[model samples]
Target: MSAPTAQRSVLPPRPSYAAVLRVPHARRAFTAALTARLSYGTVSLALLLSVTRATGSYAVSGTVLSLFGAASVLLMPVRASLIDRHGPRRALPPMATLYGALLCLLAALTWRPGAPAALLATAAALAGAFTPPMGPTMRALWSELVHDRALLQRAYSLDGVAEELLYVSGPALIGVLAGLAPPACGLLLSALLIVAGACAFVTSPVMPGPRPAQAPHKRSVRPSGIPGLLAPVAVAGGVGLALSGLDLLVMAFTAQHAYDTALVPWILGALSAGSAVGGLLNGALPWRMPARTRLCCFAAALGLVIATTALAPDLWTLTAAMTLAGAFIAPALTTAYLLADELAPTDARTRAGAWVNAAVNAGSSTGALLTGLLIGAVPLGICFLLSGGVAVGTALVAGPRRRRYADRS
Candidate 1:
């Protein structure tokens, strides 16, 4: 008898870039993006409206926001650790529910004409602590859905653009709502939206689960350990500090000149719009600069923009300068994420992402506090110039070390 024919194996045809994005899972990831944006948008509006109305002072608003930011920074690793252990679905729902409930409580408690500052601060801290790890989980899901690394990069770029749109439209929407109704109305609506968006995200078919072998560690309190995480963490923290300083400088300047505080939202909106535009351009451009170069360019450009704002002669010029300055925001943020991904171990990606987030929030808080203190003693423009100079100096010192770390990794 003739020898049995040897079995032959065939490889599946490779998918095209377009095909990957069109996959069902990838489509779900896109939907998740929209929901995530809506959720965060609502939270942002609530924070802005609640703090400003309760304290009747932008300084207090900044302080409350800074506190909320600190809460998020402190809790990010814990939330990420949960996701790393329990899978996104199991971990996210409880956190989201708690967060939504707390938001509602905060809104209800602060509805009075003059809520106590301590109470408001407590509410803000709770909201931050319980806010689900949507950003990182969504990103983790994106990694699972897309088969190609280039596609993953593109996906992240698109997500960054979406974030720009969220910040741009979200705060403006909040401001409009607050103008029309009471700030509490905005806060209430924010709670509802957060609940809706978060639930939708958790239920999405594309959300990934941790492998069965990687059981949720009941005792684990920190995110999975990863090498070289500190580098990205440091860079992110510095960038956050710079952005927070810039924010405070603008607010202080506006307040000192008695410019309509209404314009504050508009200035922030311009920055967001610029970031969105930058992300779009980055996506369309063929040149993919090394991550380090992108970081350096963005940091330098951001410093210049802040400095220019200090020199603007009128509101229009200031807004224009802010818009121009925003061009670097997305690039810098994107590079930070890329570095985090590079440094993170396979099992600790979510934790690594959280580290980056925490760094940014910490830096922002520090910068805001520093700038706020200086505003009382110096001219706003001088504070702006000083902040910008500090940002530039920090970036220059950190950029080289960051690049070296990236290379070693």
Candidate 2:
């Protein structure tokens, strides 16, 4: 009898790490990153201005933001599913167009004071539902473009830093525009930028095509569900809660003291600035350390910094504490993303990433509400301490489990 033919390896040839870094696709990915930053900034600024102007209530603004977040969390998976089925090029443009149009309509509807809460809620929901899946789609495209895993890691680090910049500049620009012109003006401008950014990214030549159809045997090579996906999701959710608590603490302190509402902006700016610094450092740091160890250390540091915020004698001290807390944000977040990527089944990468996002938003919403309730019942310092403690505890619990799972897998 003839010997069986030798089986061929199915894996694609791995590219050199340096080649991936220098590729045109990496450059194009960076452009898309910039566009995402600008679009987020515009939308955030408009939201803050619109809610505040219409309701004259910070509580209303917070509620609206929370609702938008919840909506985004619920809808992200749907958008990711579309990308997995249709490719980034087909999925992005329509989502962006719908989102932008909704924002414009929202601005028009909220132009007058005393706009109906239902109308505002409907507009916010629509905007959230249609928001482009830029982050996930872009990451998927980056994986396809940069052939080296190391280069992909660097790309993610840079993207994280860009996100920090968006938070810093986006709201500040909206505030300035609203003050100079009107709230509606900022919303209109945001819509224009969203359309522009989405169009630029969708038309980019480097975007990946839809996955090809294959026989059942060929398709069986997809990634299987990792044994411990739950741990990372838990960690992400905990971190989200911590962030929400911090936000509430800042808001409550500012409101009670009647200091420049501008302090809120400055505090957020400090946090974003610190996060950007962390992202830059992430690329330079030695990657030999275990991901879990680094994440635990970062989370512990964040908790300590947050707890110290209670000791601040003035806004300056509080800002300093916040900056320190922010320094850990990117490191821990990067760890989570790396873990998620490692744990994801090949066919479910986008969905896995979206799940992480959803966990975060859900945690944040929970934390915000929890902190809000405690503001009247407890000392502000105590609230911060409790929130920080929760974060530290969560990291201790989840970090080790994540490592064990990855090691086994």
Candidate 3:
């Protein structure tokens, strides 16, 4: 009996990005959820394209998409709050089911003529309102499954990589499907993918349940009340603003220019391809600076790369600059997410993530509108320069405060 000593429980070594799939239902759930996410860039674009065919007006289609985005942004925090309160098991399935059904309905309605624009907008709003809170759920799962900071960052990086890849694949898939048949066909497929994904995620046992903090910790934890949270949220918005501005600039360039009418995609693809590579490499690395430091460094590097894009006079130069600039985007965002996770109270995880998302949406919407207004009037290069300046300015202001926030923690 004396010889029998207790052996401490050591978690099987931290799972690498590849190994993350080995967790129970992780492969199935992640793959399914990915399909659901694929619907993201598809449905809205598909609707836009389909409606344009019907009414021959980009403005109407644009209005619908804008309204959907606004509706989604408004609902993210609310949906996340519900998930946090009720736990995913009880909450996610109903929302996903409703969302998928609404999308299917939207696709069906698009086939008919004389469907009022208001009715279409209402359907989109409903779909957006019910869209499943998958991103935050995935992040919360990673946080729960991987306790070590190093491994967790890897997880976030990997997640970031998937998101970048989606930028390519989502639109490509939608384009292909639409080209093959009706644009509504692409939306139909998107709905199916989302429904299938919802089924997979809802049934997954790996989902972390509601974790009510201990009494003492609960009293002390108020993630929104924390000192440094707003800074990262603001930076997230800035990132969105810059990216959207760049998007509009590319759109304007492609629309007006005859040589490469389709160049916008290639440009955006380069940006995403670079981001994918950066995210993977960043995750694979064993050594990393602190999240706050990484955030500032990545932001500054992004600033430099984006600023250089202003010098691009041709497609090659623009592509090269975009590729280089895009690399820093994912890494900076990864750091911001990690910081949010760190600073937020355990109970507030989903809502905190939602806030980050909302910031991005807000920034993207505002930036796109502003850039659209300015694109024809200004030298196109000025857009890149201004976006880069924003990034650089954000970094400079955040750097010292980042250190202070860490110290306070």
Identify the leading candidate in terms of lDDT: 3
Best by TM-score: 3
lDDT of predicted model 3: 0.75
What's the distance in Å from true for residue 358, model 2? 2.4
Instruction: Put down candidate 2 lDDT per residue, 1-409, tens digits, no spaces.
Output: 3333223345544434344457785666657656754766677658777888887877777667667767877888777767666777887789889988988987887677787777787788888888776766666666666545556666667666776677667877877787788787777887887788778887777876665433333232122244556666677777788887777788787877776776797797788788878766775565777766666777777877887788887787888888888888887776766666666544555655666667777887889889989998999989989888877887788767435354453
How many clashing residue pairs are found in candidate 2? Answer: 1
Q: Across residues 1-409, which tens digit of lDDT does each residue of candidate 3 receive?
A: 2333323334355448877666556677778677777777677678787767655677777887888788888788778877776777888888888887887777777775555788788988888888886777777777877777877878888887886677567777887887788777877887787777767776777776775743444323233554577767767777787787887777665655444757787788888888888887777776547766777788888877887777766777778888988888888787788888897777768777777778777888988888888777788778778878777777777774435354453
The lDDT per prediction is 0.70, 0.72, 0.75
lDDT of 2: 0.72
Task: Rank candidates by lDDT, best first.
Answer: 3, 2, 1
Better of 2 and 3 by lDDT: 3
**TM-score for each candidate, following the candidate numbering:** 0.79, 0.81, 0.88
By TM-score: ranked, best first: 3, 2, 1
